[model samples]
Structures are given as structure tokens and as C-alpha cells.
Target: MTTNTQNLSGQSILAGAATTGNGRAVHGYNPATNEPLEPAYSLIDLDQLKIATAAAAEAFESFRSLEPAKHADFLDAIAENIEAVGAELAARAMAETGLPEARLTGERGRTTGQLRLFAKVIRQGDQHGVRVDPALPDRAPLPRVDIRQRKIAVGPVAVFGASNFPLAFSTAGGDTASALAAGCPVIFKAHNAHPGTSEIVGRAISKAVADFGLHPGVFSLVYGPGATIGQALVADPVIKAVGFTGSRSGGTALMATAAARPEPIPVYAEMSSINPVIFFAGALSEDPAAQAKAYLGSVSGSSGQLCTAPGLVFVPTGAGGDAFAQAISSQAPNTAGQTMLTEGIYNSWIQGVEALGGQPGVELLGRGTEGAGQNAPAPAIYSSSVEQLLENPVLQDEIFGAASLVIRYDSAAELVTALSKLEGQLTATLQLTDADHETAAAVLPTLETKVGRILVNGWPTGVEVGHAMVHGGPFPATSDPQTTSVGTLAIERFLRPVAYQNFPNALLPRPIAKDNPWNLTRRIDGTLTTTGE
Candidate 1:
């Protein structure tokens, strides 16, 4: 099959327009066909980094002072612009990342949905988090001074895009959406795998900025080597915080860079996770076929590229467990080999499978149908005892592909011991029945300590973008578990609170002003209300 890669003018979008960056040239390739796409993108080196970040810093002055409703309009405009270019964005993303058209299309929707969600968040005024205290000048011993507090944008943000979920995690993705919603300008570093898609989305965001008559520096997208370009961005004094979604090593490196800066900055990175699924006795003993189908579907979706994929499953030992294992082995082989996002990911997955198969007390149960592509690999299932998993620490690392391990446990104590050994995860699932409530209750506390989102009798493949969704977890799952990268709260990562003491009403922030210009919800004299006493 012949396909035409877009003749994208590979250039960095610096402060709202395309520029041939002053750095070495980098080119993107079509992973499906192993063909290099047209036009070479100029890597943003140390010099271009200064220009982009400086623009963001300059823009933050005005951007942060804009009214909350104006910020909402800017965010809504970005969403509209993204929808305008949705078809082209999906097409470019599929050609570069080897993802199917439908998946890319849905991701485009998710990206725009996140933008609109944040727009609503800004308009609601909760993010401002205002509190005010009236002065008690008539006090006998000492007169109390008036005090006010509110949240404000940290400053310019540097966002590193992810290889998977190009539209939802790259360019104008969650990180950019949240930072912009917080009133911080963005200095985005596009992933090398999909520069064309980045360019297209970057252009759309730039157009939105102009349409709203905002500063051109409100958004910028650059591309280059991870070590150089990424490091430079994080180290820039103008960049107050960072947002990243990538491998553990990659995320850690950016974290180190931010820490080494003269004034250390926060790096909100979504790194690695081996989301585990535990099947209680009742769940394992009943409806084997349906459970098997759901398990396979979660593990094989997007070739298991999702961070929330069920990488490990625990089941009880004996006849019921054997039936579950048999069902898994039978259903797994039916899923055909899928084209991975990159050649490196495919090779790493093969090594992971080989390591698991060669480990002590591990058995290869099934292998799916293979496809004819350089970056395509078949899904595989392996089995081992809970004791073996406890013995081998290497088994806990993520493989980044379509694969999973089924561990059989002899007793409830053994299941707890095995789960205790797991590293921090994005999610954990409990396949339960009404009869298993006692067991579920016992494990709920442990699951809370090890994972961010706990699922009940459902797969963790789809993450909804909303007010309450937490797409982050402790440590390896993310740099900070307190913040989410996909919800309204994500804006908090780029915001910091400040208190105003003894300031006159005219000098106070609008949200905290005496007259309540914005009519925001705030605490006044220990009472929550829009009107001050």
C-alpha cells in the first residue's frame, strides 16, 4: 500500500509562528512503513530555547493578569480551533505513529474535550481559592490587620510531549491545556516521533491565541533531541514548572534538570506503571469467558501502550484458577499482532517476554498471531506462582507492549504478600462478586497505598477527562500523586497561592477586592460567601 506523507514544513513554532530553529535538523519516520517523512525539522538548541522561554516569560505578565472569563474564552477558542483541524491532525498522527485512524480521531476529541473542560474550570472560579479576613481595628490589646489570599499562576511552563497518545499528550494536550487554563504561557517541546502532528496542533493553538487577541507568546512548540532540548528547557530560568509523560528514565532526567536549576522548579511527570488486576475467588470461579475477554481487551488495546493497561493479574490456585488460566490462554491467541508505536518499543517488548519466559518457575502459556511489519509484534501471556513473583524483583518493571503475567496464589495471605511487592501504579482492579465483599474490603486499604485509581470489576484502559479524574499516582506512576495530568485540578500544578496582608482594597487582587468585582466564592471572617462582611 502506498501512502503520501504530508510535506510538512518542519519548523518550530516559537512564540506563535513557525520558524526554522537554529539547531541541527531532525526528521520523523512513518513507523508502519519505516519510511522517513518529508521535510526536516530543525531542533531547538540552547539559543532557540532562550528565545522561546523568554517569549513565554514576557507573555506571562499580561496573560496571568487577564480576567478569569477572558482566560475561559481563550481556552474555548483553542478547543474550537483544534476541532477545526481535527481531521488533518488525526491523519498526520496516524501516518507518523502507526496508530489507526479511529484511535487518533478519538484522541483528538479527548484533547479538545480537556481544553473545554479547563475552560469551564476557569469560569467556575474554584481554582482561584480565595480567602479574606476583615480587619479588627478596635481590639483591646492589638489591632488585627486585614488579610487576603488567592491562587495565582506560577509562571511560564515547559511541557514535554509523550510518544503514545500524540494528540492527547503532545502539543496542545493535557499539560498545555491545564497550564494555559492556569494563566501560564506554555513552552512545549514536541516529541520527535510526531513532529508533523505537533506542528499542525501548534499552529491551531497559535491561531487561537491571535483570534483572542492575546500575546503571541502564549504558546510555543519546539522539537529536538531529548537530552539537549529537554534539558535546556527545564533549566531555563523563565520556566517555573514542567509537565511530562514518558518513560521513567526520561521523566527522572527532566526532574534532575529542574532540580539543578538556580531556583528549583516543579516537574509534574507521568512516568511508568504496571497496573495490576486482582481476581477474588468468586470472580475467578464464575463467568470465565467474559472475564477472559475483558482482560485480553485491556491488555491488547493500543498494543498495551496505555499506562493503565493490566500488566499483571492474580488468581487463586486450583480448579477455578486453572479454568481462568485456560480461558486466558485460549482468548489471548485470537488477538492478532499489532503495529507498535515505535521500533524501540517493539524490541524492548521482545526482550521483556524473553526475560519472563527464561525466569525460574515461569511458563509461556500463549502467543497471538503475528503480523508482517517491522514494528509489529504478537501479544503473549505468561504464568507463574506468587512465590516466584515475590522472589524476582525484575518482573515488576513495565514492558511497554501487549503482554501480561498471570500469577496464581495459594491463599489470601499469599495474594496480599504478592501485592505488597508491587511498585506504585496508576491503577489497580478488583474483579469481584457480591460474595467477595469481605475479601474486597480487606484488600481495599492495601490497594489505596499502592495505586492512584482503584477499579471495581472493570478494565483500566479508558481514562475519563473530568473534574474528579486522577491520572497520576505515587512515585514511579508519576512524580507527584497529589496532582493529576488529565483533569481540572491539573491546573494547580502550575499555580501557587499567595497571601495579601494589610493591603488597601484598591491594591488587592480583583477576586479578593472589597467590592467583589468578580463575585467569586471566598471565605470572609471564617464564613464562605461571595459577599464580604
Candidate 2:
């Protein structure tokens, strides 16, 4: 089959309907047939980076000052627009990523839902403004000044599109939606693998903006190749904060660039993880086979492209472990490798899995190659002692494809210790029973330290969008501990709190005093303040 590649190199791409990206268009191939899907080009590059970011910064000057209601409406419109183009977005995503239609549709639902959720959240925040701690006074001999807090928009935001969720986490996804809702303009750097999908989503966003009469500078989606474009974007004075989801080396590079900026900016880069799931003997003893059965779908779902997919499974070295191992082996090969997002991605997954298998003290427990051709090798599982994992950093890095490790421990105490060694992650699961619940309780305090969320017997691959949902975790899992990747809280990544002192009613934001902007919630004289206080 023949495919077309879009070329973005040496082209102008910002402030207009330009498909020309700064980098050359890489070919989009059909993994199944090993044929080209379509001609695709990357988004434009460095020169365009400035154009996009500058436009976004320009937009913030006005967008940041809009009434909170207006901001909420715009957010709502974005979700609505994404909803309108659901089919096109999902179809392109499947073609680019080689994922099944059902998965992409679910992701699209989640994506649009996230946008709407943020809209609701921001409107609610306005209805009952962000909370602020007020100073003590009246009852005291000495009076203190007022303390006020308002969510402020940081300047232009640079968002690096994700390779996996091209629509939900890319162009019009959580990063852009939340940032815009926060009243910050956005500069979205499209991920190379799915630039066509990015363009479609980007166009949807642009149309939404025009329909809403929003500032054009408020959103600029650019494409480019090479590290230089991203490096330059991070260094730009106009971009105050960043959001990213990709590999460790890639994330680290952007972060270092941000840190090196003359006016250093905040970068929220979510490095992928080998999300670990712990299964106590008691938990698995009753239904080790069942646990493995459920995990078959979770681990192999999307070929393990999800960061929250279980990568490391902890089990005792005995009959139970053997049963679980057999279960995994029985189920793995059945799910043949589907196509990954790109050839480059497929290759990387293959190499990384082999590299891990080849690591000292590590043994392949299952039969499969990492990734091959358009399809990935079947899910690969390796066994390593908890002690080895504790001593080796290699055991923790993410492979970004269909793979996992089974870590054996001598005792529950050692299991606890091994859990403690892991860095922040999106999730940690405990496969336990009523009896093991006691052990799980003890491990919670330690396990929670390493992950944003803790699950019991359920897979973390399908993130729910709700109030209690916390989709971000400690370092590497997410750059900021306070922000979540799913649900309403995700918008916080795009917002910064600003405080107002004893300013006249006109000068103060509604949350602080008599102005009562949205007439919701607030703090007054060290009390739970409500609107009209």
C-alpha cells in the first residue's frame, strides 16, 4: 500500500491555517500490511515555535483577564467542539497508532469528558472561588492584613503532545483544555507520530476559538523535528510552564532545557513508568489464575502503551507464583502483537525489552520478543529477585510497550521494602484478600508514597474521571504532585494561585471580599467564608 508523508520542514506554520510543519513529514506506514497509510508531515519547527509561543503569550494578555464565566464557556465550547468531531479524531488516531477502534473511542470519550469536566470544574471554582486562608483579627488585640487567593494564569504554556493518546492528550486534549480553562494561552507541540491527527484536532480547536470569538493567539499548534525545537521552546521567555508525556530521556531533555532558561519556567513532564502491581499470596492464593486472567487484558491492552499498565508484578516464590506465571504465559501469546504508534516506537519497545531480558540476574519468564515489524512481539515477562530490583535502577525504567516483570520476594517485609524503592507512579495495585487486607493496610502508608493512586485487584489502565480520581503521582510519574492527569484537578496544571491583599472592592477578586464575584465560597476573618461575606 502507498502512504503519503506530510513535510513540515522549512515552512511557515503559525497564526494561519498552515499544514506546513517545520520538520520533514515522516511516512505513516500500515503496520499490518507494511504499506504507507498516507502522506504525513510534522508540525513546523524552531522559527514557528517562536511564532506559536509568542502568539500564545499575546493571547494571555487578554484571555487571562476575561471574566471567569467567559473562561468557563470557552472551556465548555472546546469540549463541545471535540465532541462534534469525535469520528474524525478517533479514526485518524487508530490509523496513526494502529490501536483498535473500541479503545480509541473509549479514549475519545475520556478526552471529551475530561474537557467537559474541566469546564464544569472551572465554572464551579468560579461559582465558589478557590479557597484562601485568611489572617486572624477582630478577636485578637493586634489586627492582621487580609489573605486572598485567586487562580492566576501563568503566561504562554508549552505542551508537548503525547504519542499514545493523540487526541485525548494531544492537540485538544487535557493539557490544552485545562490550560485554556485556566485562562492561559497554549502552544501545543504536536507529537511526530500522529501529526495528521494532531492537525485535525488542532483545526477543531481553532474552529472552536473562532466560533467563541476567542483570541487567536490563545492557541497555536506547531510541528517540528529534532530536539532543537523542543529545547528552544523550553528556553523561550514567553512560555512560563510546560506539560509533557513521553520517555525518560525525552522528558529529561525538555526539563533540563527549561531549567537552563534565563527565566526558568515550570515544566510538568510526566515520564512513563513501569507501574508496579503487588499481589500477596493470600490475595492470589484463592484465585491466582483469575488474577492472571484479568491481568491478561490489562497488561496487553493497547500493547502496554499505557503508563499505568502493570509492568512489575510482585509474587512470592512458590506454587502460587507458578500458577500465576502459568496463567500469564497461557494468556500472553494469545494476544498477538498489534501495531504500535510508529516504526520508531515499535523498535524502541523491542530493544528495551531485550535489553532488560539481557540484564544481569534477569531471566525471561515468558516467550516473546519486544517488538517486531508492525506488530510488537507478544507480551514479555521476566523474573527478578526483589533484592536485585532494590539494587538496580534499570529495573525501574519504563519499556513503553507490551512487557512486564515478575519480582519474587522472600517475605511480606521484603515486599514492603521493594515497594518503597520505586519512584512516583500513576498507580500501584494490591491483589489481596480479606486476610491479606491487614498486610495491605500496613503497606498502604509506604506504597502510597510511590504512587498517585492505590488500587485493589483492579487494573489502573482505565483511568476514571471523577472527584476522587488522582491520576498523577510523585516525581517522574508527574512533574507536580498537586496536579492530576485525569478528572477536574488536571486543570490545575494550567492554573497558578494569585493572592490579593487589602485592596479596595474594585481592586480585589470576588473570592476575597464584598465584590462576591461568582457568589460561592471564600474565607473571611479566619473562617470558612462564603460569597457575600
Candidate 3:
């Protein structure tokens, strides 16, 4: 693939129209070199932000009622459009995020792959969630009226781009893809760190909306101060829900704002998690050194910027644990740190690492070599006892970059007690052998409550985007644990079920009509049945 870098206007795209903002202008920066990129992006004010939301509300009406095939085709078109710009998109993302070309390219593939997956999902028609209860006029003293139910788009959605994933979690990313697949027009708030990348992807989505002859309001990408424009976008009456992926502070702020609205809406925000990795004695006994290296790979990958990076590792206290810690200490000095996503994130990582180090009972176990590039800091691993971990909340805080805490436990009881202290997380991995099943079983229930996904003998760095994958969890991990931010399940966030009763088939929507025009598999009288059945 070749770098294109051609038609980046650095303008806000509103309803298929390119418009420059009058608010403060910001430029994307190269974190690796500590230099600014070309074409400063102008931020939009509150009035201009309102225009995008209002247009999205308008687009939702027609978009929600689109034919299943056309809707599916629209999503497919977006994937194709993004793939067409794959080279340029990857290049811009690399320059802005300090991520390597291969990583950015893989992220771009994940983004487009998900879009195509959602296209298949919508075409399958099960997302409509059609259910019917037939009228029983001749049975019993009380006659039953026909009732039908199907999920509908919740209206316009406000998606905040994530700082870590400029391609897969920014403009035309999973949140935007899922919302559009659910038939909710999206108003994407471009991440300032990657404005040029946002514009390129945003244009791809805008092109799809136009090519499908859909309302221009189907998609809009705007640049603005997150404190002002971001909050206002969530508070807008037109936006029925929000999709956010960032810090705990940012997600909670949006949650508070949404709750304060006259009609409180759902905010599906993927916020904080220190995805924990547990090491059973048997698993680590084989080659504690190799296991330690694998753990570091997950910790330092992408400068530890991944949401699923193993922030907390539990090692059984004994010779094996000592060996593992010793291996980390010996190997870490040889490992080289990579460039972080941005300077702000790099600074935060430093502060968080320092705070953790300052806490009582915490000791540095290992520290990696610092990268030669700007904004790249050395990765560090710390050690603490389970008792200290349970007492100190600072030890559990996510450092967000190339840093992890290793907690040692003497017994299963102690380990379980410390595990209970953890907040909700996106994932938890149990590095256990067959002999360790009994111990794993004892802690399984507690793990179930604390995390959304559980893995055995693996790390949590790579998230597979598929039908069964869940990239969200309870509380601070996400506002709504019942929903997800990746895979086909993400569309559920932008949809709500509506039931129709005693309505004639002529007046019913196609998905729930007696004819089953969309040929969906619906539950009729509590049984799954296809059209013509």
C-alpha cells in the first residue's frame, strides 16, 4: 500500500457538506517526532454543532425506515469506500498516533471488516427482533388481541472518537458502524489528535450516504473542543443516545449530562479497565521466564495504550512467583519502549506510574529501556502483596501506558479476597493448567461478576471483532454492561424495542407485519418461524 495524503480539507463535514468552523483551530501532531502535521483543523462552535445534531435527527426518520437490502448495501458501500482509501488512511493514522504502519493497517482492516460484518447482520434481519402473539378471539371468556414487537433505531447517536484507536475507534469506526447499521444517523466528534485521519474516513462515510441516495444527515464529522461541543452534543434533544470510548472522567461526565436531560438516554461508553491476568502455579512452573516475557508483550504492546492491556497480574507467592518477577526484572531492561499515541497520554502515564510507585508497599519489579523517539517512555512493572493491593486503590488504577502492577498472593483465599476488591473490567485471564482447574473453579463466580470476558491460558491485548466478542463491561468499564461496543451486538445500543397491539397488518411495519415482507425469522406464539411458515 502507498501513502496518498491528497484531499484533506481540514474542514468539518456536516450532512454531506464541507464547512469550516469558526471556533479554535487545532492541528494533528506527530507524537513520535513532537511536530505538528499539515492543515490545522478548525473547531465548530455550539451553533454549528447543533446543525449537525438537527440534521442527524432529520436523517433518522428515513434511515430507520429503509429497506433491509438497501440498508445492508449502504453499510457494504461504506466498507468498500474505506478500503479504497486504505493506504492513505493507514499513513495519516501512523503519523498522528505514532503507531506503526502494520498496526494501523490492521486496525483499518478491523474497522472495514466490522462494517461488512454488520452489513451481513442487518441483512439476516434478526436484528429487527420481531415477535408476534396471535389474537385468540375464540378462546376463553376474555379475547386476546394480536400483539407484535420489533426493535427500532433510537434516533440520532453521538459518537466520541477514542484517542487510542484512531482508525478502529475514531471516525467510521465500530461505534459509527454499529449506529449506522442500527439505522441511527451518527454525529462523530473527531478526535483532535487525528483530525486529518478523521476527515478521510468521514468523507468515505459521506460518500456512501450520497451514493445510496440517503438523506445527507445520515452522517456528519465535526471538530470541536470536547468540553463544550461534546457535552452539548450529548445534551441535544435530537441525539437519542451516545457512544463513547475514553477515560473514566470523560465517560462519567457524558453519563451525568445525559442523565440530567429531560428524557434521560443511554450512554454506551467504554471507559476504564485494568484487564487482570491471573497466573496459577502450574502454568508458571513450566518456564516462568517465558511466561513473564509473554506477559510483558501484552503490557508493552502499542506502548500499553490498549484498553485490554493486562494492567494487573496475579502471581502465586513462592519460588515460581520469585522466578517470574526475577525474569521480568532481567528481561525488562532489554525491552525497548515504543512511541505512545500522544504527548498528553504520555504525560498521564508518567504521573500515574509515579503515583503508583509512591504508594506504600509498592516496589519497582522491572523497568524497560526508553525509546529514542519523543513522547516514548520506558515501561515499568511494580510488585505488591495482595493485602496491600486490597487496601490501596491507587495500585489498581490503570496507568494507560507501558506499565503494569504485579500482585503476589500466598493462598487461594488471599487471591480470591484481592480479586473481590477489583472494579468491573473488560476481561480477566486465568493462566492455569489442568491441575489448576479446582482453584479456577473456586474463583470463577467472582471473576464472572468482575469482568465481561474470561480467558484461560491467554493474554487480553488482542480483541477479536466477531459475533461473540464483548469489548465492554460493568460500571466504569462501560455505562451499560448489557450492551457491547464491538461486533454485531453493538447495534443493540442504538436500538429499542417497540410493541404494536391490536393493529391491522396494513398499518404494521414490514418487519412485524403478518406478511413478513423482509423474510425475517420471527417468534410467533413463542416459537421461531420463518416467513411462509
Top of the candidates by TM-score: 3
Q: Which candidate is the best by lDDT?
A: 3
lDDT of 2: 0.74
Backbone collisions counted per model? 0, 22, 0
Candidate 3 per-residue C-alpha lDDT over 182-290 given as tens digits, one digit per residue, 9 for 90 to 100: 9999999999999999998888888889988999999999999989999999999998999999999999999999999999999999999999999999998889999
RMSD of 3: 1.7
Which regions of candidate 3 fall more than 4 Å away from where they truly are?
1-5
Query: Which segments of model 2 are wrong by more than 4 Å?
Result: 1-13, 19-23, 42-45, 126-140, 368-373, 510-513
- The candidates, ranked best first by TM-score, are 3, 1, 2
lDDT of 2 by residue, 1-533 (tens): 00112332222236444646646656555555456656556546566677777777777878877665777777777667767767766676777788788988887788777777777766666523455545556747787766667677778888889888877788877778778777788878878777667766676677767776777888877767537777787788888989888877888888888888888887887786777888887876777778877876787778888878888888887888888888877766665565777777777888888889888899977654444455666777788998789888988878887788889887878888888888888889888878887878888999767888888878888778777788888888877777776666666676667777765667776555566667655655445555454
If the candidates were sorted by their lDDT against the true structure, best first, what order would they fall in? 3, 1, 2
lDDT of each: 0.86, 0.74, 0.91
TM-score for all predictions? 0.96, 0.91, 0.98
Error of 2 at 271 (Å): 0.5
lDDT tens digits by residue: candidate 1, 1-533: 00112456788878876788787887788887788886789887788777888888789989999887888988888788778777777777888888899898889889989988888878878789888878999987999999889999999999999999898998889999999988899988899888888888888888888877888888988887888888888888889999999999999999999888889999999999989999988987768778888888888889889989888989888777888888888887788777888777788889988888889898987778776676788888888888789989767878888989988888877788788888899999999889999978888888889888999989988999998888998889999888889888888998899999999887888888888888788888878898853
